[model samples]
Target: MNTRVNETERKRIAAAISVWENEGGAPGQDSMHHQYGRRIEADHSWTIYHVFTGVPARFGGDAMTGLSRMDATSGMLRLNLRNAERRRERIELSSFRAVPELAECGS
Candidate 1:
């Protein structure tokens, strides 16, 4: 089944979890881990996944493009940072163990 919603509508859902705080929306929060996934085109898309609820949400992306005059929302899946090291345990590379700190403050 293909779940689809207008991008504008999807943005409203994304705005809730969006890192960027808006006028009236839930501010972003620190997560044990992040989740990501994308569905077929013309379908509901979300990058954030709630493990407990079993529902996913979009991470949201750049509002606009300067060159193309186009708007882009985040569709790319993000690996959850929580237990990130454990996830990389299988890999031998030491660099994968490093997790970047969030530089932004949530409202």
Candidate 2:
């Protein structure tokens, strides 16, 4: 299984996350932490895993995680970016861990 989010999609996802973080988005709800998977070079879809720490205990306390299936055409990284955009709650990340593969992209 080639679970690699291509450079193009990775940047887009990173940008969206940056915006969400800067604007104070909530804990990802159904909007986040959902399991998603994709094979490499199949219909231009990609899969990436995200692990977030420093989240409030109510949300899951230091082990918040999610996966996104990115479409080449639509670029859907998170499960629901709209949900994240609507909320203005803050989440603190003491440490951020993306897939080891992403490190190659310097994410």
Give each prediction's root-mean-square deviation over alpha carbons: 16.0, 19.0
Candidate 1, after superposition: displacement of residue 6 in Å? 37
Local error of candidate 1 at residue 86 (angstroms): 9.6
Candidate 2, backbone clash total: 1
Q: Show pairs that collide, candidate 2.
A: 28-32
Superposed Cα deviation of residue 62, candidate 2 (Å): 32
Off by over 4 Å in 2: 1-5, 27-107
lDDT of 2 by residue, 8-79 (tens): 788899988755543334545454532222223344333322324322112223312232232311222343
Model 1 worst lDDT window (10 residues)? 63-72
Candidate 1: segments with Cα more than 4 A from true spot:
1-37, 40-47, 58-77, 81-107
Model 1 per-residue lDDT tens digits across residues 45-102: 2223343553444334432112110112232212344234555664534443443332
CA lDDT, candidate 1, residue 84: 49
> Measured by TM-score, how close is model 2 to the native structure?
0.22
